[model samples]
Target chain A: MLPLSVPFIATAVLSVLGYVVARKRALSVAGGDIRTLTSLPHQHGLNTALSTLLPPLAVMMVWAIGARIAARSDVALVPENPTMVYIILIGLAVTGFVLSLLRISTSFRARTASEGWIMGLLIFASTIAVLTTVGIVLSMVSETLNFFGQYDFRDFFFSTTWSPNFRGDSDLGIIPLIWGTLYISFIALVFAVPVGLFAAVYLSEYAGPRLRSVAKPLIEILAGIPTIVYGLFALVTVGPLLRDYFAEPMGLGQSASSVMTAGLVMGIMLIPFVSSLSDDIINAVPQAMRDGSLGLGATKSETIRKVVVPAALPGIVGAVLLAASRAIGETMIVVLGAGAAARLSLNPFEAMTTVTVKIVSQLTGDTDFGSPETLVAFALGLTLFVITLGLNVMALFIVRRYREQYE
Target chain B: MTDYKISAKGVQVYYGDNHAIKDVDVQIEDKTVTAFIGPSGCGKSTFLRTLNRMNDTIDICRVEGDIRIDGEDIYDPAVDPVQLRAKVGMVFQKPNPFPKSIYDNVAYGPKIHGLARNKSDLDEIVEKSLRKAALWNEAKDRLDAPGTGLSGGQQQRLCIARAIATAPEVLLMDEPCSALDPIATAQVEELIDELRQSYSVVIVTHSMQQAARVSQKTAFFHLGNLVEYGETDKIFTNPEDPRTESYISGRIG
Candidate 1:
């Protein structure tokens, strides 16, 4: 079996050769009068190269996938016969090159044919993305079904206690984890929304161009910082500060890692997501709207409140929903700032564990794949997926409905 | 001089060092329709915006010299531009109605200015403003409908109604009928003639025929200077300036 690089190099060299040969043939057919040909020489060359490239690459991909699937069933024959695979791929490429070369005539529409190939490639790339999402959901669904089969669905969903043991009597109720997730996300949104919205308004409406140019990218830099860095900041800074300053003094809790700590840090991480998107949405509200309000003797703040903000309300709602989904799915900050205690409590300062944090802890160490303890991660993940998906769909609906309101 | 509702003396406007409006002086009278006619970028709109201090919203734009509305310097630091704009309402080149109900669009100005004492007062103001703009018949039944849902002509009238609801002493229309059809243009021209009975109406128009039809007094501006200013009939018939006559005759804009 030859190395993978051999076929790749061969395909590249063959494609270049095919391009040059096809271009020369096209020019000769035109007899130096380039306008007589339907498509340009370069387009004919590109069509020939694409014909040599796409079909053999598609066949190789299919062969590789087939071999991978067959390998799981102990059928090693296909994977071991790489020589034959290479020969067939190379033979197909050469055949395509020669066939397309013959078709490059004075009247042949090579440009349209190459464009069709590019369109097909784009569609194929998008299909891979869509199919990957489908595959993830299917896998999670099957594992969740396994979890429900082992444990009663009602107990998994309804029971209040969550205590997993190695001896098989495990109370894996999802309510407490869901409660922690929602509670933390709620706190994050409560802290982030007004601050982010104000920042967006100031940047879009009030700030001069020079200030906006400097401030907007600086605010967006918050989004570029890794979430794990935010987690560390949560663990080292915000957690201790909240524990000593508020939680312990107010008789809430003594622990440094609490829901408030994680929520505050996550909110900091989500400010850019809200501000950048809201800024763009606010800016999209037409300048004419502002002029109309201002020309009617409304002050700047009054105009923003009564006219501009209302016009951009639907888009702002969508941005907030998107940020909410991000908050709900956040895991790194929760794992570090919020302690691993899946307790159903209303006190924000109390130590809590979210669905994402529990998903990480439940599957990290040694565990049987068939056990409900390990399979429960998939259930939690599926629930989170559905929640975020619902939020995204709602956001899309709001944005689309808002678009029809204006010209 | 006391009869002039708006008076500008040696007014100059600059947009980031581009002298948009050069040294210009004009006196606009009360209860009369004064039309500013010129080709595009002739500073007609810029000079109109100065009347209500609307150009104050633009950061790069700077206005110098005196622009007084009813003997009060509008650009004075002591005067609030918000209050000034309420006294002098403006309509734009395009129909820019708020994305709101027809009732709300008209009521918005009066509501913000505290001109209405109660719901009935606000309702009366909206009805009167709509009737004045000639939009009451088409819009009265659908007061709750979105203002943007109206036709282009109706939307322009709605904007005019919005501007009039504040009960401004001076109405500045910047090509208000440019976006309208010929029929709508005629309707708006008729409405403008009626508007002159109460408020000092200043309009910037591109069509010379429109200037002749709607204006009592016409001011021809060329290259940011007032080329001619007189009665509408005299300006259209025998303009003193060659540039004004050429512009009126459709030769050099």
Candidate 2:
């Protein structure tokens, strides 16, 4: 609630002042003899600045979080006193500044102190990112536990039907949503992997420089177009086209908003992901491998198929797995193209809904926060996160293994 | 009247706008070890590549005039380079074994060309080729091991075995012993001496001593031209060309 800019600006000015004071003090203490000091003047300056800034920043973050937690608790240990907190934080900063200024002598190893603080800052940055991810997972897990408390865990996981009722007797089975997600993702991969891989081979192996420069960018343009635009395209164009020409005429279900529509649109969206990654991997396979095969009386096609492709296969598989992970977490395209019907059907032409779509629907309106219906969204999110996380880990392992073999 | 296994007439090679090999004519004899020695950028490698049509893989490279093998025009429109390559096998300076097992690397050419009717036949060919390259004892037990896992010399010998497995009439080696240790080089040199009894072997070497030791015929190339071509002893002992004398005596490359 305290305007954060004021303290931030003050801290920055204090750091600059601290640096100038430390550098001048070190110089005077050394009697301008640079060789006699244990560390350089700049090291002293950096050490002073880090000491002046870091402690106050840490206290400010901790105090804010402590205030929030105390407000939530039955006993408010940290009283609602932002002004007092600000005063204490500034006092701590002033103390750090005085102590570090006093410590800047010729014999003191200020370089290590400065470097240690820099390392601490870097570690803090990385920990913030890691802790944010952990925090998200923890939040999702707690909400999901709450959901299971209200809804039977067995029915939520096992039952085939997903009929969520706001009247508290809901059949919130995850099976139907999972099936839709996997089936759509399967269809998309079946359409994408071969087409995308072949496009990669062609671009990497056959295309001339002129053609590749134009074509590669054009393929990447598909990646640059937002998923929302792709969703709209799916809703407007591909869904109806499939329903009329192929699905309905063949006596399949006549719904325009079918899994087939969403799957195909998603596949088109993922082509660049598969192709570009595979292209880089295939190109990375050394030209020496190809030359060796060709030198042994193998034709161009034979060399590529038996040698280059096999060598690049592991990296290509890794790219496909990463693309598969991306396809699983995809949401907007499913929302618009596949209708909002959480049904357990095998027919690609029939309308189906994924877990992400259900999550969005469950959380939209004036919903009770404690109700099982809204809580189910967290469970769905946690499930999706775990599934994608496993796929990503596997992909990374395969790519690292492949690189080790060649390198 | 013609005992030559290969012949070239007015062979000129161009890379894009630059003429790489200029007006070269050479007749390579059958069942003899011939050596081409030159400094770097001398087009000795380029002229050797023309014999097997390996230069065709380069987009900018162009070759003119006739190159014939066994008195047959290899550059004829009717000839397929794939089949031509089966007749003429090549080994590169760096040992580039395919990323397959040792057995598979040797079996690649024979399998593609249908040289074997069964697995045993293929295995026999692999064994015989390995033995011929003097690599049988070291690599016999680990034929299933990846070809790239072998030492530099063993890998080069494996490549030689791979080339010989197809039973090519001619072998082209572009500095085969350059990447090997002296011991491996001696082993390969001995193998090359034995190979001269069967296939027409043409080697391009930077080492003058290696050229003298292995070859019966030697060709010295300078710039983009063949400066001298004669018996190895004559090229070394009494050179008609001053450039050849200067090259052999380490005066100028």
Best by TM-score: 1
Whole-model Cα lDDT of every candidate shown, in order: 0.91, 0.89
Candidate 2 clashing pairs? Answer: none
How high a TM-score does candidate 2 get? 0.91
**How much RMSD separates candidate 2 from the native structure?**
3.1
Which whole-number lDDT from 0 to 100 does residue B252 have in model 2?
Answer: 91
| DockQ winner | 1
lDDT of 2 by residue, B1-253 (tens): 4999999889899999998888888989999999999888889999999888889888889999889999989889898988989999999998888888999999999999999999999999999999999899999999999888899889999999999999999999999999999998998999999999999999999999999999999999998898889999999999999999998899997
What is the Å distance of residue A43 in model 1 from its true position?
Answer: 1.9
Task: Report the poorest 10 consecutive residues by lDDT, candidate 2 chain A.
Answer: A65-74
- Expressed as tens digits, the lDDT of each residue in A1-407 for candidate 2 is 45556666688788889999999999999999979999999999999998888888776666565664565565666646667766776777778788988998889999999999898778767867886797699789989999999888898889999888888788899999999999889988999998899999899888988999999999999999999998999999999999999998999978999999999999999999999999998899888787777877789889889988888988998989999998898889998898889888879999998988999999999899999989999999999999999999998888787664542
**Per-prediction DockQ scores?**
0.76, 0.59
Q: State the RMSD for candidate 1.
A: 2.5
